[model samples]
Target: MKSGEACLHRLVDKWLAPATVLSVRVVRSGRMPAQRARFVYIEAIAPSGSRGMFFFRHQDGCWRVFPPHDARPSLCVDALAA
Candidate 1:
């Protein structure tokens, strides 16, 4: 995985483990109009039936997770190892 994806993987593994991840969906994604940075909006669901959304922006060769513009979650839980 790329460095950005690797960051997300570590985050998910560190905090979201033990819970089965149901899905991860991209809500929005694109590059900055006048910059090299890229942004992505993502949503995730868990087997427990909880769901949330988050935003990520790529900068300095890394991906940083941020709180959504709205009230959705800032941390997205990816698939946890079964």
Candidate 2:
């Protein structure tokens, strides 16, 4: 994994540990137009059978999980299809 991916790994370890990584599907990914950001979509399923799409942004050598303003969930699928 690259540094950007490493940041995501750290995030997984921070928030989603004590759980197993059942699967991860990279639905979409690309560089941001006119910006220092890269977007990635993840279709993740945990060992407990939970599923969701996580939207992440890699910008300026850091990945902070996207849409930090939302209180509902840190991840969703709409971004993956964007």
**Alpha carbon lDDT of each predicted model:** 0.54, 0.58
> Weakest 10 consecutive residues, lDDT, candidate 2?
64-73
Assess the local accuracy of residue 27 in candidate 2 as a C-alpha lDDT between 0 and 100: 71
lDDT of 1 by residue, 35-80 (tens): 5456665556676765444435544444556522333446545644
Candidate 2 lDDT, tens digit per residue, 1-82?
A: 4654647667655544445867666678776564536666655667677554454564345566663332243677898999
Candidate 1 — number of clashing residue pairs? Answer: 0
Clash list (residue pairs), candidate 1: none
Candidate 1 — which residues are off by over 4 angstroms?
A: 1-6, 12-18, 34-36, 47-50, 66-82
Clash tally, candidates in order: 0, 0
Model 1, residue 4: distance off in Å is: 7.8
Residue 47 of model 2: what lDDT?
61
Give the least accurate 10-residue stretch of model 1, judged by summed lDDT: 67-76
Cα displacement (angstroms), candidate 1, residue 61, comes to 0.5
What lDDT does model 2 reach? 0.58
lDDT of 1: 0.54
